[model samples]
Target: MKASIALQILPLSHSADRLQVIEKVIAYLQKQPVNQVVTPFETVLEGEWEELMLILKTAIELAGSEADNIFANVKINYGQILSIEEKIEKYHS
Candidate 1:
């Protein structure tokens, strides 16, 4: 993997179960090989750029299917030799 992507998906559901939809997406992401961090506003994933793109597509589709509307906020950091662990390891004891 040569790149990392942080994807924050917000599903606008007419129903009150919006969090449920987000949780479903998180569960799906958890199954992938990408290193992932779930935060209050986004989920950061690190892995191959191509693989991450594919996963993004799947995540969007899954969220769309589960909600009436969806918004995805994506941030990518690339072109350097790094990994998710490298970026956050220092913060961990």
Candidate 2:
């Protein structure tokens, strides 16, 4: 894995069923190959850069198809850094 991406997807639907769209997106991401951590506001993914990018792109497309408007905020770190597990190990008992 050469990079990590923190992806935050916010889907706005014309109807009040926005949560359903968000949940569907999350479910799709969870099935991907990269290591993923789902937080309250964002999902952290660790893996090859290209693979991560694909996941991000697909996520946006999927959510946008289901919702009226979808916003994907991505934070990327290049080069090899500590794995997600390393960063949170201290907080996890």
Tell me model 1's lDDT, rounded to 2 decimals.
0.85
lDDT of 1 by residue, 1-93 (tens): 477788888887776378888899999999999788888888888878899899999999999999889888899887674776787789995
**Candidate 2 at 45: error in angstroms?**
0.6
Model 2 earns a TM-score of 0.91
Regions of model 2 farther than 4 Å from truth: none
Candidate number with greatest lDDT: 2
- Flag regions of model 1 displaced more than 4 Å: none
- C-alpha lDDT of all candidate models, in order: 0.85, 0.87
lDDT per residue for candidate 2 within 1-93, as digits (tens), equals 488999888876676368888888899999999898999999998999899889989999888888878778899987977899999999999
Report the Cα lDDT for residue 84, model 2: 97
Scanning candidate 1 in windows of ten residues, the lowest lDDT window is: 78-87
In candidate 2, residue 12 scores what lDDT? 60
